[model samples]
Target: MTTITVSPGDLPLQCLYRWEKERGPQVYLTQPTGGGAVLDITWAQAAQQVRCMAGWLQSQGWPQGSRVAIIGKNSAHWILADLAIVMAGYVSVPIYPTFNAEALAYILAHSEAKALFVGKMDDTANIKNGVPSGLPLVALPLAPALAALQWADLVKNNAPLSGQPVADGDQTSTIIYTSGTTGKPKGVVHTFNTMAWGVSSATHRVRMDVNDRYISYLPLAHVAERMLVEQASLRYGGRIFFAESLDTFLMDLQRARPTIFFSVPRLWVKFQQGIHGKIPAPKLKRLLGLPLIGNLVRKKILKGLGLDQCRIAAGGAAPMPADVLQWYRNLGLDLIEVYGMTENSGVSHSTLPGSRQTGSVGLPYTGVESRVDVETGEIQMRCPALMKAYYREEAQTAEAFTTDGWLRTGDKGQIDAQGFLSITGRVKDIFKTSKGKYVAPAPIEDRLVLHPDIEACAVTGANLAQPLALVMLSPDAVARSQSSEGRQTLSTSLQLHLQAVNAMLEPHEKLDCLAAVTTAWTPENGFVTPTLKVKRNKVEEVYAPHFASWLAQGRPVVWADAS
Candidate 1:
């Protein structure tokens, strides 16, 4: 067996040059058009377009290392634009497509981007308001009609860039803004060497090759998707696929039949709920207990989910519920938990493929060092791929690291005897009740989401008698609650669930009641981040005024109208 090795100093462009010479005819990207139409771009074709775009970028004659912004959902053109930015000796600033007008404007103005590349987006109104006046705008192939330069026109007009241009390893490659939950988003700057080092070192833990395939559905603006899907594909010469839209996600997954799949915990829970919708849990459990029928049922479920061919499946960005993790394991899928953050270039700890430990996020990746602060119980880490600084914010950057240089992850955790790391909670997420006892919401919320009726939850009580849990029900549960009997049934089940969760907690940490929120928690509503993380501060702001009143009249379960 042979393996591809990359040094810490290797650049992404160098890998592209290698693939262009070795696998030029092989398809590198598969993009879905509406109505099931598709476009397959070979390495040779991608290289030519990237080169031409690079030439056009150079023609603008922006100073080297000037910031260039990209805003769009995940697509082949998104990746190509990023590569072109790098090839043109510019810094790429990727803004999440779901960002509202304010966030979009902040990043663009703050980065001082010389130009912007607009790609596939569900809403163009945000872009219209967010883009500053007189800034250059280039539209990708899938972009909606906009008053901007066309990508096809530029490629057709400019010749391919002469020679294989490479960026210096130490030059800035990108500035990834954190999907902040508390305050304004901060820009995390990473150099070419740091970004390349992260992707290169990750291969040692999860192997990939030219034959590997992936579906790039997660936002490429996120560090996880950028490193795992885009950069990893460039390094290993793998084929990358794009999901057309949310409506066609399943069809896109089936088309890709990806060999490597990565997803967050919320999506994983939704997948489980979808499976249970088709096959009830009790009957499915009974079938899985049988001898040969169990294997067949497992395969059928995996096939239906479009993950039958997945050799490596992992979850990150948040903790995986214990029951959900075990349920996928029972289906013969090794769904390991990966733990990392944007500041670390998305490199930290990950569970090995076949060596999973319950309730732990595995061991740290090779070349990574981790420790838990004795006083604060915070998890601190040092790795070669850590970011250079928080862009332009000296105070925040200084606060993000210790004097000795370990990145402060802001997460509290424990390291087991076997070296497995189990996250206890976020340091900033802990709240105190009126009695002055602090409660860690993460561990308790993990237990709350295990109920099939609940989709998401937040446990919060500041200076109150007892902490209470505010929960958003799953879509099926919400629909079922429309009827009188159905509402009563859901109320009783939630009461029981509240009792079960309380029985496991200490007196001060126990919840007062379970409040069912009638409104949805979504990114648009500012209830959750783009990555689906609950915004604790937002939850507190909207529900705090009614907390005392609800606690006074509350039984084991109560209802709150967010709207």
Candidate 2:
């Protein structure tokens, strides 16, 4: 076994201290607002704001360990509040900005956050739902219309913490809420050291230099972003630029020109769909197949997306269909697949450079021990970066760790003879059909998702005779269905493409019944995780009530259920 050593205080905060000492007030964050660099904050300047906020918190007179939540989109203020919460010696709970009112209420109440910092209140209704009783919230980027107190005002007016600064190495850093298969949310508590360890471990695997620029678009509340941005950025002294909205996301990306870009399968699917729609796949493939045209076409496409200089492009939070992986690789964009959970501080393994393999999540990072439980086939990990416990849930905490402390990931995976790990299906996700045959949905869905039409899918039939799939088609696929239906008249010529996909799939994994919900699966809707993986059970419930007749039909391959 190989080993990697990390010295104490060598985390993100250490990076900031280095930057502050070496280069005074260099730009660390920026967002293009109006004219010149709308918002830019240097390391020292940002630290002053954080210290001021920390002072304000000390003035609040709450318990030192009370959970403080951040309720808004990404901003310089958002980052500062997160670091300030830690500086004030409080646990920071970063909530998804898109969570609906009911979910907001549930999380706020469950986490017992004493105060909140809300940024970008465009979704005020959702914000209101999570507002705790008697708890004060300071809103950043406060507009005239929003009723929340201004976070900037609070920080500006309050004095900085007078005494010794908080540099606790083992304090509880955060409690990130992840939606459960049971339709509930569990808060995963991680210590500063655990998160710091994750960043350091990933640095060795990815070799993140000080020059790396990360676009922080994924919800910071997620383990993926928290470790990468909060922990890794802090340790490596990289700049973080948050996307303003969909309108400016591309512009922001072009402006930041990030060295490392990480997005989920859904976003990647959208990008692929955009390119496919612009130039039909068959035509583009034929053009690229030509010797002279191939390199030029790839270069043009990469430049158009501003990924010509991207060092690493990664996709995770869900299994990436191999064909999509191939499509990008063909265009000279090296997108690698990664696999991990919140329990492992977001990244347990990643496909290392020069060792890329499609259909496999790749080798475990240094110091992370992974073994498949022979009985259940579930992957278990023992690492220095493992979470302290599920917040306030003692029984759950005890259940998570083995007697010797290996964390049960609950994800079923297999390691090839050479140690490349491929996740198959979740132990909790695999269920028996009414026929009593155990069905692993992820593998089946992975096969079906390779079809160009499918955007996202979930397979469910726990007690039914056979498995069924609920698919959300890509925008292009939906548009093509309109024309395809006009041309054909039978199940052979369909009004919807789900039937076509069902035909394309190998029998059991095919769609048993299909319906056009036409709604996107997103973090706010509770159907997807913050990192954009479908919460399979939530997806099943949302569509299951509409699939009664299909289930009654014993999972026969068909179009919509016959009323």
Candidate 3:
């Protein structure tokens, strides 16, 4: 594991050139084509394609700093297009592939993008209505058929850009839009220097090298993926693999055998549930306790999940349930919990390898400075990688930072005596009951989701007598509920689960009842963000009207669709 040393001031393009010169023949990206076929791209090959595309972009005569937008799923071409955009002296704006037509249109209009690069996407029905009339569009290799210039044509028509061009450190590199859990998405601006600083500083803690392998499946639009996968790879010169689709994700993971893996809480939970489906929880637990057979069972499970080679498995985007974290640990994985936000380049804190503490997000990164506000208890941190500003939002930009300097994280947290940070809840998310008791739903929701049948849960009862939980059943649970016998079993299990969760909570925070809903919550339905964090406001808006009726029912567990 030889580590690459990069200067803190080196920009992304600088690192790209270094890798192209040193690791020219080494594979840089492994992209999955349909039907299990993969295309291996070398560093020199990727550099040539990037240079040709950059030349084509430069020939278009857009201003040096004009905005260039990319909309698509994670693919090798997506990364190539981003590098080309920066190489052409333009700013890149990456939009989530799952964004609705309305969101797509708003971002394009807001950013005033000069051209758009379209790549592989699961759904393109919205493109017809989402893209403004007559916007210049270029299609990547796997992009759906569209009336646009093709990437192959551009590469054939243009010569590679002549010399290694360097971008100014202070120049704006990208405008990343937040997932917008509450309001309209705001563009977070980061300079080349800031982005470089984040990647360089993070590598000191995470320890990546040319021998490492990574799979890029998370939304590249998110800051975390951008920094960890794209930029980090450039700095460390590691090979990256792309997941073809949801159906082939496991195959992709097995193919890559990634040495470093990162996932959100929801996906991690699904992985756990998948294992339990094959081996029931109680039986699996008993099997794992045997001295001789336990190791074999652990290896089999890890190999089946394609995580046997993983040295660093990380969870982020939301607080992972303590029980879920322990489940992976029991299988010989030290799952690290990372904490950060879009405004901070997602390089704030991460638990060290082999030193994980169960209920904490771990220590801050080398250059990060953190403190909990004395008055509001909000976590505040300032670092070199902090965003420059919110694009075109002067008032909001001013409000994001304190009068002195630190960026307000808006999350309430506390630093323990050992300097580990534990997030309590969001300041804006705390609500009060009618009796004047305030309850934080995050902790309670964490406990409720420990039930195998529960997929997602939200606790809310503002101004009501007692707080209540709205739960969405797992796919397995929903399938079983089709039978009367299975439904009865689920009802009994949920009632007992409710009682156990309530016993662990304070009187003011105990849930009145658990209401299992029939509707599925997804990004398409505006219930969850692309990162899969529940939109608390949206959940309350859709279910608040039924609170009184649900309370009136005397049953401990009620079905929202039941008559």
lDDT of each: 0.90, 0.75, 0.90
Candidate 2 Cα deviation (angstroms), residue 511: 4.4
Steric clashes per prediction = 0, 3, 0
List the candidate 3 regions with Cα displacement exceeding 4 Å.
Answer: 1-9
Write out the backbone clash pairs for model 2: 12-234, 12-235, 434-464
Q: If the candidates were sorted by their lDDT against the true structure, best first, what order would they fall in?
A: 1, 3, 2
lDDT of 1 at 546: 88
Find the 10 residues in a row with the least total lDDT in model 2.
Answer: 486-495
Candidate 3 per-residue lDDT, tens place, 345-420, comes to 9978888888746888889888888999999999999988899999999999999999988999989889999889
Two-way lDDT contest, 2 vs 3, winner: 3
Query: What value of lDDT does candidate 1 attain over all alpha carbons?
Result: 0.90
Q: Candidate 2 local accuracy as lDDT? A: 0.75
